[model samples]
Target chain A: MKFLCGIALIALPAFTFYCWLLLDSETFLSLLQESIPIQTQYIGLSNRLLALVPGLIPIALLMRGAWHLRRLFGLFAVRAFFHEEIAQRLHGFAFMLVFSVLAKPVAGALSSAALTMNYPEGERSISVTIESGDLTTLFIGVIFLIIAWVLREAHQLSKENAEIV
Target chain B: MSILVNLDAMLAKRKKRSRELAEYVGITEQNISLLRTGRVRGIRFSTLDKICEFLECQPGDLLEYKSNVDLTQ
Candidate 1:
């Protein structure tokens, strides 16, 4: 699990950079166009790349959350589930995920604004898209925070129990 | 904070070492030291019973309560 997260952490930035390159470099654009059907009207390279930033912001947050999640899993793998650090890492991951989920609308707005920035004033359009499925990810993040709180209480009890002897 | 463990005095009066008491009670000497120094949170009934039996003393002889007083002094 840790290995997979590490690989993903590395892969996301690389993939984002590749996409950025595709927006500018004809070579990567041709490669992507060959494999994927390009249905959208082609916008200016700078506008497309700028629009991509807001979407990439959420991915970056996810990468950070995944790093902490990986650490939590690593602790569990070593049977350190009761350690105080586990609760901290779990909470951090949860908050990051929650923030990422909540920022989705803002990201959409930013992406739209970036895309339409240079268009003639009357012609500019502001677009925002929402997908209902993202709520499930928000709920999962909340659940992680709840579990972390429970673990914190358990950790305190464990400490008291240890001192009993 | 007023509750105190008198295990050290009990062990002294019984002319027993903490190590011997720990062995007789089936616990580690480090725990015996903790109990003697009043550093532990609490003791298990089984462990308390063993200590009482091994020391040939009542539980009261091993623990006492005093009014809370200024600890800084």
Candidate 2:
């Protein structure tokens, strides 16, 4: 629920801008002419899709993982009323982390491919450099942060499983 | 790294069905089957405690430790 809400908050403005652009013709015409403000529509489509995809993925993964973990936690809840499978709990995070790291490059590659497909001419191509205020930055930042946690937990679980074995 | 769970033997001795134990432990019969076959990653302490309680056995009866045996290897 929180994840969905956060995505809504972040995506709301983009959508609002899109709506504002549509409702007000002069601003919309200016945006269309400028092309810089609307670059998000070009290369940013993938990033937008990613914000929706990845933002939702972690939640889905976490939910599925929580279901798998239900038995493990249920055991604890039934017994001491305080059961959390640390490894299983963190496993979803690890999945999100690994996905986030891979998603960016995958998104970049796909976006680049799409750009090439859409605009073959190098001069006509619409590609944005890594900028400070890019919307991609937010998604990218979230991805990086998730990856860091995933790596840490993954290593910890590996060591723990090794010890258990 | 080398503890062997003798769940099958203990369950056999207890004369308690796997399904019954599984229900009490809040795990599927497949998980109990995994335990019987010793194919689980790790059993929770709570699970071990529950199993011991159900079967009226010590942890030693349910599990055994053999030195330097790496079945996975």
Highest TM-score scorer? 1
lDDT of each candidate versus the true structure: 0.80, 0.54
- Backbone clash total for model 2 is 1
Residue lDDT tens for model 1, A14-119: 8877775454545544543432223234457787678788868788888999899889889988998678999999998998899888877677677667766787
Clashing residue pairs in candidate 1 are none
Pick by lDDT: which candidate is best?
Answer: 1
Off by over 4 Å in 1: A23-40, B70-73
Q: Looking at model 2 chain B, which ten-residue stretch has the lowest summed lDDT?
A: B64-73
Full-model lDDT, candidate 1: 0.80
State the DockQ, from 0 to 1, for candidate 1: 0.83
TM-score of each: 0.85, 0.38
User: Could you tell me the TM-score of chain A in candidate 1?
Assistant: 0.82
Cα DockQ of the candidate 2 complex? 0.11
| Number of the top-ranking candidate, with DockQ as the measure | 1
